[model samples]
Target chain A: MNTTRRSFLKLMGVSAVGLSLGQLGFDLAEAQAYASKLKIEGAKEVGSVCPFCSVCCQIIAYVRNGKLVSTEGDPDFPVNEGALCAKGAALFSMYTNPHRLTKPLYRAPFSDKWVEKDWDWTLNQIARRVKDTRDKDMVLKNEKGQTVNRVDTLFMMGTSHASNEECAVIHQAIRSLGMVQMDHQARV
Target chain B: MPKAFLVDTTRCTACRGCQLACKEWHDLPANATKQRGSHQNPPDLNPNNLKIVRFNERMTKEGVVVWNFFPDQCRHCITPVCVDVADMAVPGAMIKDKKTGAVLATEKSAKLSPADAKAVAEACPYNIPRIDPKTKRITKCDMCFDRVSAGMQPICVKTCPTGTMVFGEREEVLAVAQKRLAFAKERFPKAHLVDMEDVSVIYLLAEEKEHYYEYAGFM
Candidate 1:
């Protein structure tokens, strides 16, 4: 289901109207501090899925000015019912952490230092290396003379961050190259 | 009506979702931690971490190992001693949001002397409230006032997959706590609510408070 920013704000407005303040007999002086607006008040809600594990909890990403500001479990998603585990709860940090890599880093076979590389160069290098490795390691037959189309040395490590469609495409691409050694970060 | 939190520890699995979710909402920095031979990282609550899942392990007399997970945070007491102490030093340093019963440390808290901040922290029965050495701002859980004010659940309660944390009006939350206590009593005879009358954040312990944490209850 799609949730437009206007519709989401309308829903929030209803809940906000139900809340009342300043009846607990305490000094009303702090009311000014409490009146500050919510951080995600006007942010747009974009639905996404958690990439941590098989749970695949749905999350609502709050976007403000085209930038992701916050994230929380989607309340309408029945599977999680707006709940998330520790790994899933840290989804927001995954975007904001300074340690996260923004650009690709490459290192030569014997070089100890990693140099930053652009996406175009990184993609071209990866394609070149894969073709070279597959050409060198492709095996047509086993010792028993059985026909087996496989690349014994070219291994592909899959990531959970890849979507289902991306994974399908990746699987097909690798299989066509006769790459047999495959693993996923989520499972191992 | 004032708000309250009912944390049923019996249902907690120590996933620390609440701890991490709280940090994510506050945008707090990560702490440098080393292997402490346990899952409890960073040792204790610092300015960066206002909430933490405390792990306590003990060997029973019958040679059984008992592990208890206590998700700890500021209790937001009904009559907060921290507020009193903080106010004595700086008038608007610490105040309570009457609508939610959330004890908040204001920016004025930074005006407090280091000694006065320590006194405020010491006054808390739950040993919450941390003093940031850099900003000198006394910090602790504010019950996610920004969210609660918008008629939303606190991030910690909303992220708990175990349904261990329930937030709502005080009376309704107390009823839920009592019902949970009744269910808990069937399996763990010592199960009881922790200082429900004194604090907005209530905990239902399956065993004695000592098995949970040293300051699990005001005692």
Candidate 2:
């Protein structure tokens, strides 16, 4: 009778695990495949690239209700396949950060604070400045009397945010203006 | 089957991708931070941040500088003592999900008195649970149950760049952890899995447990 009772207790212990059956010898709780609605479930998968470095790992931006909801490294991309560094992982917050500037801000030469400027005003001002600098610093003739048309004072610093095609256009436009000094700031 | 994590600390580069990924997945808000003279930011876990990578650097007995990175989170115990302690105060306040081996503190946790709430947090061996002063809700990692149940890996495991944080079925992950442990044993004679029998998440430490964190393993 004691043997029967002990055997029943053992059976009860075995039956105590959750509804699902699992492999023996591990603390695997019987988990059912519950389908929780994904946060980005219905969001459109828009492909893009990480704007932080030249590696430019592919990213899929999740857009829901016409707003960017999330971003993750694209699994399909061979480079950095579904893996991201701290900066790359923080792409979502970079877009949603309250400190992010949504408009152009202009500061006067001697001004202590920045004032908001319209895009038209900002672009026109930039064009005028670039033209003025190019005209003032244009060196047409070298020491050897060579026709080396280049700007000596204008330095064109490029952004990592520009795409490959955009970078090519930027290079063409700057070269046409006879600017020689150029640099990029992509790290890692 | 219950999911598990095999965290190999030796492989972790401490890029904090897991930390950021958790925040992104949960839609947790950012906390204000200052230069605390360490890479361990926000210092401790709060409602806003469920997971954090703890950085510790100190000299060993041999005068060797040892820098350790611990991606800290709640180790949902096999038989959770917190759930029992919480059940006495508010019945539905804290529950252990039988389906997923997930310990979750529900909205009813707000009903728990301040003393009871503090008691629950204090009961955790790993010192993981935190009671929000404003909400009175006992907050910690819920094993990322929502994502795991939906056939998706927890954000931390998915975003890890160095292949440090691995998540999968309990038996499979245990095998992985043991195999890695065998490899680690060659270099680190003292390397072992931390509280593997009692917790869902297992950390494979390269050296003594105290070197990583004082509460890294439960005796």
Candidate 3:
């Protein structure tokens, strides 16, 4: 084996405890008890992409017993090089955020509270609103008598959370609805 | 062969990735915090937060507004006074790991009285080691001994986006600190390493300690 001095020193560092607080006449039994097994010891690492911002840094998700044990940035990735920003670092919490909306919430026009609604009901309401707004505000022609085919009042706001493919589909869907004023949340 | 940390403050952008990563790795619960006009949340280190990115802002005599970020944690001192103080009250309360030179607080620290616990915390030069109100035990950064034992870097060091924190063998880390200090001195003439000789975790401060934190270094 090609063991250099540096590698040998690292091996020595890992394998031996030259001096401890115990040798200094302090009991380390309690501190030893504090050294529990690593949480990701037996976990399986699965590579995934971070779902934040334009820089989709690769992440290693540690899964144990089919559940996510932990997550961190992948060291091999060139973009982030194992480094994560504040939002990327908090990926675990973002996954397990209790306040995250899993179900659609709907609040009536005059209501003060939002009640849980099914996806079908939510989608139907959205479609109806979009159609009504498009019908009311569609500008088919300008003063120059040229077809514009645009809706003035309707606007589409894209989310940074969406993947590239999803953004493309969203763009097409909004364009088909004659929406012109489109902006992305990521741009802000 | 002991491990050490080089915290290059010049590279830190106050993103708080290290702080959040520490909390995530330890599975520590979040503290309820409000906007205190500064990005430094929860104010200071507590039971839940073993590490925090301290933010300090001051205007120089030249009318330049300078903002500094200090990622504060237990220095894991070479001759930890916290261990001495804690050992006086509770023998097994704190221990220094031989191989990594990591100063760790144990569950046995709960045996200490409020006065003894406060004394242990007060003994730290960097003002680390907070006593948990509920557990009545000392709490501070443990240098991620479990992770280090598994041949992995500490969460704070691993998650630092700005390359502010570097963890490795003592000699190599000291070299890195010195190199970073020399580079920082070119830009900030007052650049220096804070108490490098006394602690396993060395911080390369680009400016005076007064512009960082009151307890940024030993008195």
Q: What TM-score against the true chain A does chain A of each candidate get?
A: 0.79, 0.75, 0.69
Summing lDDT over every window of 10 consecutive residues in candidate 3 chain B, give the lowest-scoring window. B144-153
Best by lDDT: 1
Report backbone clashes per prediction. Answer: 0, 0, 0
Expressed as tens digits, the lDDT of each residue in A30-63 for candidate 2 is 1222223457765787998888777778888989
Query: What is the two-chain DockQ of model 3?
Result: 0.40
The C-alpha stretches of model 3 lying farther than 4 A from their native spots are A1-28, A46-58, A131-148, A160-166
In candidate 3, which residue pairs clash?
none
- Top-DockQ candidate index: 1
| All candidates: interface RMSD | 3.0, 10.2, 4.1
Q: Point to the candidate with the largest TM-score.
A: 1
lDDT of each: 0.88, 0.82, 0.86
Measured against the true structure, the TM-scores of the candidates, in listed sequence, are 0.87, 0.86, 0.86
- Candidate 1: residue A123 Cα off by (Å): 1.2
| Alpha carbon deviation, residue B180, candidate 2 (Å) | 1.8
Docking class of 3: acceptable
Q: Candidate 2 regions off by >4 Å? A: A1-36, A159-166
- Predicted complexes: DockQ each: 0.48, 0.22, 0.40
Q: What is the C-alpha lDDT profile of model 1 across A1-188, one tens digit per residue?
A: 59854466467766774655445334455555444567787789899999888668999999999999899988888889899999999999999888889999999899999999999999999899889988898899999999899998888999876778999999999899998889988787
Ranking by lDDT: 1, 3, 2
Clashing pairs in 2: none
